[model samples]
Target: MDSNNLDRELVGVLFPGIVKNEDKAITCLGGIRNISQVYSNPSKRRLGLSFQPENPFVRKIYGNSKKGAGVLLKVKVKKVKEGNEIKREVVSTTVVGCVKTMFRFESMCDFQYLAVHREGPSDGPVSCCLEKILPSGVEVIDFMLQPSPLLLIPSSFTRFEKPIGYAYTDKRHPDRSSPEPGDSVHSKTRMLRSSQVSPYTFNLTNELPSEPHEVYVKQKEIKFDLHPRLIEEYDVVKKLFDERPIWSLNLIRYHTKIRLVSLKVIMPCLALYMKTGPWRSTWVKYGYDPRKDPAARKYQTLDFRLRHAAGVRSMIMSREDITTDRERKPKRSAAEAAAVSDEIAEGSVYFRRGMTPTQRHIFYQYCDIQLPEVEEILAPEPPPGYLCHQKRGWLPANTGEICRDHMFRYIKDTLFNSNNTDLKFEGSGNGSSSNSDDGGSDGSDGGGGMSDEGGFGSDGGGGASD
Candidate 1:
């Protein structure tokens, strides 16, 4: 509370953990304790000391001193037993001034307070005092107290390898039938032999008989002289070379339309055409416009429109439903639509028409389905009275009768055509009647021939052979 005390430097003591002698002491930042006030009288030229007791003497020293002042004291540290543990306690002894008289002041005073000031604590009790006091100018300096050497309490000793009461056996052991020490065995008679033995020894000794040299026979080497002929002369070889162009041509014809459907199909076809030449032309030819065909065109356009609408709808409905009924439903977006379209274009869709039974079989093969089951399910029953003609490969002699028979039989027997109640022969009341000009007669005699084509010579052949 005193303004003079405010100008005075404050100082406090610290007990550092560890410090080398050359290291500068760092200021201790902590609460003050063990506050002591010192007053000097000019009459006696004597100093008086008064202190407030605190748990660590340094805390009180720090509290009583001015802001910055040189505090000198000899600290006595002792580790005294408290309860079951020994904890350190520090006691501070401050020297106010040199002793003017030897009269006793208090019962707490000890001979350690009589020691002269030294830079640090000495081994024995030494006398010390504060002198040369100033009113306002005071420099604060702290002596870092050294802590007592750490005494390590002994720990209970433990043995790392302790004896166990029971003996342990290994779980992994060979079976009883496995080879053991001192077992008599023949190498050749063993069921299994070591791979180290030579395999050739078994073949030489076990299988063969030794024989003496036979009578001498002269060996002759026969050689035939061959003259090379041009490969073009062999019809088969020449045909192979010549057919390459035809194959390439057929490929071009068959694959031109197929290429429009998929590049995967197109690329292999192109490679085959390039390798085989013109032979693929007939197969690859696009005779009819796929889009112009009425039935196929309508179906394709409807399919395309439906796919596009579905894709648009999917793009619009992009949110995934979280409810249980719709949790597993796929999220629809542009990318998903594109993926679905790609799958559809890659896979085959069997349209209702334009496919023969053989073509359907091939399609099933393309789809990797078994064909035998399909054949069994769709097998047709033999027509009445046609059983005898079927084995001989002969139809009725009349052309009209044959056509009439096939149309009626196919309509009656086929599952697809059986329900067509309006089925009838076109342009004929009697389906068995022939409408040809010769009335079903074979035209060998030329009954309606134009006059001998201006009369050729009838004797023997008169035309020039050349």
Candidate 2:
């Protein structure tokens, strides 16, 4: 290797397909590339004029020195007969793409190169004296690379799709072990085949490995106490409303440790639930009016379409697995949900994927199997000013709705009754507080609820009402 040659660009030709005599390989490339028997690639599909004595492309390539360009040609083979000898002849040639022999100087290790013709005697044949082989850089082609559109590659994040497994709700022998008496009868034989190491030895009554001690891992003792009378719960719930205006059923059950059956009886006496607007699907304090209070901004709802940032894993469930998950849950009451107890509890372990610096060093010292990392996948944080707790614009409320007559035959004006707003005026903050001892729909005050004071993003007093 010459030191001066290291700084120089190597001349190379970027060919797409192998130069092979096989007809099938030529058909795959659509007759654009030449054949190996004719071009004679010495090694690694390399192109050098030094190899063959009868290659016809050498003259065509070297003849275009001043052009300073490499070319991809479409050539077809046809039989040519001269007397008794018949030879394969290239009858067609079309220029597909021309490669420019130019290079960008900055941060570019890749470039195209064209071989130049060496100066020689006028009567002598031209030759190129250079390295044995120069590696080529690849560039995309204009033609369709794939003829079929059925094949595709999915994202790596989608490792566990519907193809993995369906929902399995079997309660007994979750590991599929033979725990039944029928399974034991099936294993019966005239000769004793049971070994000490056999999995059949595993049973519910199997003794512990260490000393016999009390085991309580699977089932926790959840004792449901007798529910207090609804009249007595009214005062406790009113105090709860004073603490927080909005609460979900799960939070209601989790905080007070009350069963769902009692919650149903007590909830109607105090808080109200809405099907729409900011407090949709959750309990809202009955008498709190959004009109005069700054606290209304805390529960205000905003509508914005969410999409994962580019190149990030999607938070949306893959549709393929939705069917299995949907079948697991049927519509159930709040009490039934409380019994299932899917609420998040305190002191759960949330871990990162990669090992700590000390752990990494310790694990790198050996090549034994170890437990896999346990990183949790958390959702990306919302943009600033997007959360419900954030300060809102001069917008009256998150949303407000009109209460009109339910008659379909004629149009009617909205009904406004603000009298109930004074009923639970001592709820939380200002003259208005959240939580329900006596339930009322939104803006139950004298004039109209928050809906009369405009909503979301509009001038106050009947702005943005729907």
What global local distance difference test value does model 2 have? Answer: 0.32
What's the CA RMSD of model 2 in angstroms?
28.2
Candidate 1, 185-271: lDDT as tens digits: 532234324222111111112321122112100110010112122121222322432333112221222323222223322222222
TM-score of 1: 0.12
- Which number leads on lDDT? 2
Instruction: After the best TM-score superposition of candidate 2, give how far the Cα of residue 252 lies from its true spot, in angstroms.
Output: 2.6
What TM value does model 2 have?
0.24
lDDT of 2 by residue, 1-466 (tens): 1133233333333333355555443343223354333233322232222123222222211111112355545678899899999999877765555544422111111122223243556667545422212223452452235232222223223332223446778643334444457565645533224211122121223331321112211111111124336445556776887887655554565566665555655664455553333433445666653323444433432221111222111322332344432133457997776666544332111112221111100101000111121000001222335323212222333221111101100110101112122232111212111111111232222113343333332322232122
* Top candidate, metric TM-score: 2
